[model samples]
Target: MMGSERSRMLYERAHGLMPGGVSSPVRASEPFPLFIKGGKGATLFDVDGNRYSDYCLAYGPLILGHAHPRVVEALRKQAGEGTLYGAPTELEVEMASLISSLYPSMPMMRFVSSGTEATMHALRLARGFTGRSKIIKIEGAFHGAHDSVLVKAGSGAATHGTPDSLGVPEEVARNTLLAPYNDLDAVERLMREQGGQIAALIVEPVLGNIGPVLPREGYLQGLRELTSRHDLLLIFDEVITGFRLAMGGAQEYYGVRPDITVLGKIAGGGLPIGIFGASEEIMSWVSPLGKVYQAGTFNGNPMSMTAGLETLRELREKGHEGLFHNGERMRKGLQNVLDDLGLGYKVQGIGPMYQLFLGREEVWDRAGAMRSDATLFKRLYQGLLHEGVYIPPSQFETCFLSTAHSQADIDRALGSYEKVLRGLRP
Candidate 1:
């Protein structure tokens, strides 16, 4: 077992100062969260001096892997020059151009400091553009922490058993409508009932928050049709999926274009950033152009722009085929291990991200994801940590892979999984 005395000590010290002993609720774990000392490639070293094969990958941002030479060099160069200007720079323009090239639906985009900010601004933009008060979001698909979208959120919110957070006004929650993911019928019904009042329907192309619940066949197409028919904006929250599934994200991978796209995670090259984009006409509503107000001090921070630009360039140069191949390798290996062990649990995901659900039945939505045994998952989580394999502490979250992860890493993970499963077997 990995000795976590130092981590425990830190958590103990942090308990009094921070809420839940961590800045992010998801970072807090049962025994205590592991305090990371440093990370390189697909590996992380904890404060306890133990090494872990990091499947969490900073929750899907380190697609190029931690501290990639290109990203590091770019950051270093930007740091030496300037970090933030509080004003537009050439780098921001280049970054925006790159994103637009990848996602043609987004002719104009504005950068922010986090996915939460991006989603919030996107919602506001939708409301401003459509002159409507209501929005529809897939239940269990977490857009961000903002009150407007917190209704029935997943991810850490799901893990903590608080799908709806406190402090969000009831009126705000009432304006947000919920539909089960992968259920076109539910969404259609909702649209029919309240189409006139809804500004947009925001959804994750794949439900990353409650594990990787993929869109049903023709579901996304149907959504596109519905939104178009109703003259409502369609927002795809691709924060977790952007640049991880493909260079153009789920829009490219699934061949469905949304009216507005919220991007973060890998787009920032593991730094803090968020982006919301739409057609030129739609984006014209934002400040400095039209009435919608949105601004940020670090909206176009140089360091973030430089890192993001380098990350996108590297991803483009390498191609997504390799990343897909790696994902397939890991999935097949994991399935083989499950089969060999006679475990009924299933693995689900697309591209370089996946989840191991503790149920044999398909997990296509929040209901199915809820069927997973949380207690079993907690045991498995601890077991994996003991084996020096680190996945997201919560089963509700998805695991990510980076370009740095090799076949050897997959094998080692599988071996550890086998050991853990065998031990847990009755």
Candidate 2:
């Protein structure tokens, strides 16, 4: 199928109820979303039989790539047993243990259905433990669509945050403090201003929502030290970087630990799963162990556990051979090719995730990231999509690479990118 009429018809029907004709606002792109049939390895097929070497990888959950045979087989087997039992299973313990072992910050964990739930509960547990109402979150850092995190730093990243959403109550957003990513001084200022009121500071160890902006040198260690000096808890939102950064996560990468850690995306293999864990002392503040109440009927569902467990097992077997360093090699090769083309661009990434920012501006933070040439980036994205290399549609979002992607796939994308940049230039 080649942009067949059926995809258009489907979008038309979807528009009647689904706002923007998509479930998530971010997924709605220029020329509308593409409807896909099925995927195998790293490739996806659309309704019109168009095929692409997908780098989006469902926004980083499919590190093993789309419909991985091992994960698919496990899902099928679990399907035969049952879907959801609503009871504890040995698989839950196994997966949680695996994650805990990888990220030492997570000594104990609770499984939930989505990253949103993982972060939402983390906020609650922090507040309950500290009896403090305020929380510090990095600006432009997305921790799900939760109200507390939906705030922007006032007058840019230097000031306290203001509500970013319409319905998020002022009282709720007031408890949320914001700072720019990669600026530890801003974090220190917030700590001095609201340390007593603040219960915890939550951040994406590596910002993924706005490409893969990494921490500036000494940024993570500074935060760790500052939080320790003050009486506040540090939280690492590792949902996107958890399993992909190494089988361990970003906290492991930086060698800086947090009081609580959030896990999602890659942890699920490809299914929907979220987890938050910490030392026994901090986790004890959660329900049953303490007054903080966090519960989900679908928590620790067997399917997510099975998916997470199997994915970890597979990665363990591979011994980090194909999962991450492969992505690094691909990124370096693509960057070198872009440099040869004399294209003004930058590759902001870590491990298996990356985003191509078409600009000369040093993207140290979100403001810098916004300086990219949107028109050129859009053209490049569409050009690649047409040439059978699928990436995230927006310049603001990061694209992911999976083990399913090959050197040939990277070569193809680099060649297409070079050609497209030249075309868009003149």
Candidate 3:
């Protein structure tokens, strides 16, 4: 058995100090979570001296892989200069320019600390711009922990939502409408019924939270048409998909554009960062420019800007093409292993991100993803862990590949997977 005695002891102590013994809910696992000592390239080393081939990639931020030399060198240089200045810097301007060049829809942007902040600010901007009070969100899409978006769909389809969390007030939840993802008819009906009150329709171009569920063909285009027709803003929560999907993100990959875009995760280069942007006319309503107020002390921290700028430059110079190719190679290899084992499982996702669902049906939305067998998934998780392949503990999370992962790394991972599956089968 893996020697996780140190991890177990640490968790026992942490359990008393932190809720569920983890700063984040997803970090907590049965028994105890592995305490990682460090990571380099595509591998992670735990406190117990166990080495794992990391497929989770720190929940999709390490696109270039852990502690990449360029990112580390950039951070080192920035730390030598200063970390945070709490004022404008040339680095921030450069970073913004790079992102804008890639995503022209966002001609201007404001930086914050997390994905939650980006989505929250975007929602507020949408409301301010339209002079409306309501917003429509995908049924199971997670935009962040903010109260306004922390909602669940009601009993009936395309109904007003209820607070998905304890602290969110019912009144706040009621202003948020929920519609099933990839269901244009449901979204259309909601807009027709509540068009006057609605400010915007926010969606994840590709659903990442529920294990990489993809959009139906023409679904995003359909949303753009509907929102334009109804005179409502369209917000793409690209927090998870940004940078990871492509240089321009899901909008570029799918050939669609949103009025306002929310970004985080990979853009931060493993640092905490969030960004929301729109055209000059729309963003004119923000801060000193106009009336919609938003400000943050760490809005454009030098360290984050340095990291993000370097990461983007590296991606453009040496990683983007290889990343796409490696991702497809890994996905096809995993699918082949499943085929060889005669397992009735479905693989979902696009580009460099993928997930193995313990179900046979193609998962195009949250409902189908949830139908995956959790019990079987738990066993696979445990088996993979024993084999030194560390994927996300939850079945409802996607696995990411990085430029650092070579063909050898993928082959090793496939070998581990095959061994685990063979042991599980009769």
lDDT of each residue in 32-67, candidate 1, tens digit only: 898889999999999999999999998888998889
**lDDT value for candidate 3?**
0.89
For residue 176, model 1's alpha carbon misses the true position, in angstroms, by 0.4
TM-score of each: 0.97, 0.96, 0.97
Query: Candidate order by lDDT, highest to lowest?
Result: 1, 3, 2
Candidate 3 per-residue lDDT over residues 158-209, each given as its tens digit: 4657788898887888899888899999899989999999999999999988
How do the residues 1-426 of candidate 2 rate in per-residue lDDT, one tens digit apiece?
Answer: 266477778888888979988998877877768888989988999887899888888887987778788888898999899988887888887887777778888889989999999999999999888999988898778889888988865674245357787898877887787788888888899899778888998989888887888888999899899888888999999998887777788887888899999999878888888899888998998888888898888888878888878888887776656656656776787788778878768887877777788779668788887778877777888888877888888887888877777877777877777676667772
| lDDT for each candidate structure | 0.89, 0.83, 0.89
Task: Give residue 169's lDDT in candidate 1 (0 to 100).
Answer: 82
Quality of model 1 by C-alpha lDDT: 0.89
Q: Which ten residues in a row have the lowest lDDT in candidate 3?
A: 152-161
Which 10 successive residues of model 2 have the least lDDT summed?
A: 152-161
Off by over 4 Å in 2: 154-160
Sort order, TM-score high to low: 3, 1, 2
